[model samples]
Target: MSSRRRLGARWRRHRPLRTRLAVAASAAVALVAVGVCTAAFFVIRYELYHQLDLNLTQSATLVIQQHRGEAPGVLAGECRFQSAPACAQVVPADPAKDPGKGYLLPVSPPVRQVAVGARNGYFTNITLPSGEPARMFTQRIGLQDKSLQVALRSDAVRKGVGQAAGLLSGVGAAGVLLAAALGYWVSRTGLAPVARLTATAEHIAATRDPSHRIELPPGPPDKEDEVTRLAASFNTMLGELEQSVTAQRRLVADASHELRTPLTALRTNAELLARADRLTPAQRDRASAALGRQIREVSVLVNDLIDLARDEEPTPLLEEVRLAPLLAHTVDTARTHWPATPFELDLSDASATLPGVPARLARLISNLLDNAAKFSPAGAPVEVVLLAGELTVRDHGPGIAPADLPHVFDRFYRAEQARALPGSGLGLAMARQIARAHGADLTAHQAPGGGALFRLTLPSEGGPG
Candidate 1:
């Protein structure tokens, strides 16, 4: 049994989807067909038997009534002894006497079991003396000494039932065939979309093309089904994949370009150090310092690239962060890093708590402060303001160019005037990425007075009370 089940399961798994669907539908239809056919066959059989029994009862009653006034021997003359239409017999109460030649009925054990005083007529199966199958009913006549039996030939009833059974069997076979054909048609029509989807997926897999999309034909809105939704989801996934691939290519190209300058500088400085014996002590120190600066810049750039690439990693741990204290700590750290640059803070008393990763949010604030300080003139104070749920930073240096405003947050982007600055251009970009990861928005615009203003807006759920 277990082996058979395993074989059946393996067969089902290997079957095509459409064939399975057709088979399942056919099985369901076949079950209903079988039930209806069997019920109809039995009902027809029962009705045929009921009609035969009714005729036998009427014939038996008539025989008993007709012979009520006459002698029991009189009924023997009414029916022919060997006729197919009717046959009669008189069984005497005394078992010793035999019912003679006029009796056509074969005295079977069932007929002999009938009692003389039975109010309802007794029915039994009997064979006629002429060797035909018949249905017989026995009833007591007015004379107490004899019982009358009447029988009709059952050959016609048997023939009719046999014909009907054959007809039903044929109809049942036709119904099963029709059900199979209908199931095939239904499976084909219903799974048409699935077939198309499979073909499209196979084509994409073979060609390694993300640009190909599944396009369903236009149909009524009410007709939208699961297959349609699945196709739509597939197209959406393809679109995202295409965008990711394009972004990765761009990142590689830009990173190569950015690393080229620092790498060239390091090589030049190292060449100078190789000829250190021929150089003056001061010249050697200058070359060594330049090399150190280049090395630091490369390290910072590489770290920035790593951070940007990992922006889409799994979500970080979240906790309620108090914006006020976090901003104060970031300002102090920035002040320590650039002691020559003074920092001014204009913070409101309203305390805001936001759900975010503490380390990430701190990095975001530090980046904004560092960007402001990098562009600020020596001794110029960088201004920080936190009111409601918005944090703003302004640097009183060369403001961003109008054309450069849109691209400021783009990775490795720098304006003509800012290209020679001592920093990689990933600060604002990383800050914005962090902000977005925390469900916040960061934007840069020219301050009304004379510098660039960067605003970070937290979501309402994280806003001040």
Candidate 2:
């Protein structure tokens, strides 16, 4: 069970991006380096061994020339030697005849025997006369009149080559260790800027401060490096986020300021109306009505503020709602409130359905109609049309100037000439918030017929068109 758990944990670790990348990079570099080093090491060893074999063949030829014409065929065990310990000790001066050829045998204790076969040369390791490790090489020669064979013991050369290989292996291991260390350090150095950027971004997220930006290290201004470009992009995002957050905070503060004034007025008007016994009935009624109207206006503004703030929370409550009936109710309410203005409704389908927040969606429609009625000339027609999930409200009044259109939804941004108008300048902003909450879209434009037109598009679930 413990082994199974360990395997499961390993699988989980292998699934992550950073772990996988590091493992793959390290394994690939190590494998390639080791493979190339091993190949080169073996190639050099093979070539050195081959050269040693060639030297052995040359030595055999020289020995044959020195012993030429001495014997047609001599047994290897009967050969005598006086000097040249390295040459005479390993190979007999004569060789025994075998299969029409003579093969040399070493008479020394370094090797018990040696026979030069007719095949390729090879080395055989054995104990020497001194009881030490030794190797023998055999070479055969066919002369014009007699065939000769020689054997050589090269214990020193074998030991030297073996030591060289061992040393090379040790060096290779050290090199692999050094390379791994250097590669890790280089990787860290190359990714240090990325790490810094990631750390800064994490700090900003924890603090919820969009003003925090990464400080780039001093270097040559190379924009081509990915790390440098990423740092620059992160800084740019912070700037934009700072501006957007500042704007939102300002909007909320301004909205609060706008609400405070209307609330103060409503409270004052209500207080005055409370002392109604001292005034005539007409005066009392007039004050009460004014207070009521002001209270209603204040209520609407507060609701608008709530609507605007709701946009900060993600995942609004959604429901499938019929569009035509909601529009009908909104228009009816508008007609009742502004009886002086003629209201018209032209819906393309009687049962158009869409996914949205029902209450916010209704409030958006109502706000558009209210805004149109307020701006339209008295007794003028306020046209309301719904076609293909798009609702357009147009008022036959002095349309908004093109320059002011862009700032229409800005909270409390009343036009210079329209500051005295009834609205606190948050209606359009509220309408836009509700539209966004429902995953729909809203825009304002000047109607071709010389009036302000507001178009509200309820996007399909497929996405915005």
Candidate 3:
């Protein structure tokens, strides 16, 4: 039994979803139909038998009233021998008083009991002498120990019940057919969106193009269905992927353009070093220094490119970062990098913490400080502060131009005035990327006093309220 059930379950699992749905609908209807038919069959059968019994009871009563004062022998004289569906007979209270058994209905013990008043009157099924089905009613008359009995044919009742069964069978079969059809139609209509989605996915897979989009299924804007949600999510993923690919292409193109000047300078300086004997000692020293500076420039550019690109990729994990010590440490490093420009450090709320990758956050802080220090005049202070879960870095150079404020954090963007400086344009852009990845926002504006101010705002999830 268990093995059979397992096999059935596996078969059902393997069946096509539409077929399973249709079959289930059909099976449910079949069960209901069978139940209704079975109940109706029994009810019709009972009612048919009941009608026949009513008629038999009426006849018996009439017979008892008609022969109320007569002797048992007088009623027995009217008996019909071999009556096809009906006959009458009597049994006296005393067995000897009954007519001979040869020409009368058989006297059962119950019939004898009715004659003697030992049992109440009742109806029962029997067969007449002619071999036809019948119902019998037996009752006692008021006369002493005298009783009346009647029998009626019941073949018509059986025929009526048989007709009802046939009618119900036909109706049940029609209902099952309708149920199966409706199930199939419903499954087909409901799965239409899924079918279209499958086809669209296959097209995307074959073509390797995310430019294609699925049109939204028709529905009210406020009522979002499952398929609609899934399609929307897929479209969103495609948009992000397209943007990432575009950004990568832009990064590569910009990197190549940026590398050209340093590469040419490095090649030219190397050629000069190759002809070392042709030049004097002082000139040779100058060439070597120029070569070293070009090498450092190329190195810094490459590192910045790598950092900017890596920032766009998702960080898989993070740890809680204590902003106080991290800010202090990056500030010290920036002061060393720009020793000529003094830095003013303030850690007001020293215990502020937020969820972030520690190393990335440190790099972000360093980039902001370095950018500020690069723009500050010698001996001018670059003010740094960490208070109330926010960090601000302000420089004391000429404040940012109104036009340059918006593009400061854009990749490879350098204002005309700042083009002569010795730094890649990726520092601020990379800083912003890291800030957003850690659920923080980085924005730049002209400082009220002078120079650029970069503010880093942390999310409230982990930072101090």
Task: State every prediction's TM-score relative to the real structure.
Answer: 0.81, 0.67, 0.74
| lDDT of every model, 2 decimals | 0.79, 0.69, 0.78
> TM-score of model 1 relative to the true fold?
0.81
Which sections of candidate 2 miss by over 4 Å? 1-39, 53-122, 126-134, 138-150, 153-185, 202-209, 215-244, 270-292, 312-322, 348-353, 387-389, 437-439, 458-465
Q: Candidate 1: what lDDT?
A: 0.79
For residues 54-163, could you state the per-residue lDDT of candidate 2 as single tens digits?
A: 65456556766666554433333322112121232223323342235432333332222222332444555445444444334554344332333443455555665687
Instruction: Assess candidate 2 and give its lDDT.
Output: 0.69
Better of 2 and 3 by TM-score: 3
Assess the local accuracy of residue 191 in candidate 3 as a C-alpha lDDT between 0 and 100.
62
lDDT of 3 by residue, 1-465 (tens): 999999999989998776777677767877787788778888988988877777776666666656566655424433232242235655577877865544344567887788778999888877666676667778887657856667776666667878998998887778777777777876677666666677778987998776777777777856977867887787788788778878888889889999998999999989999999999999999999999999988998898888787756356576778899988888888877888989999999898898777887888898888788777889999999888878999998877888888888888988887899877788889888888878788998888867888889888776322
Task: Give the candidates in order of lDDT, highest first.
Answer: 1, 3, 2
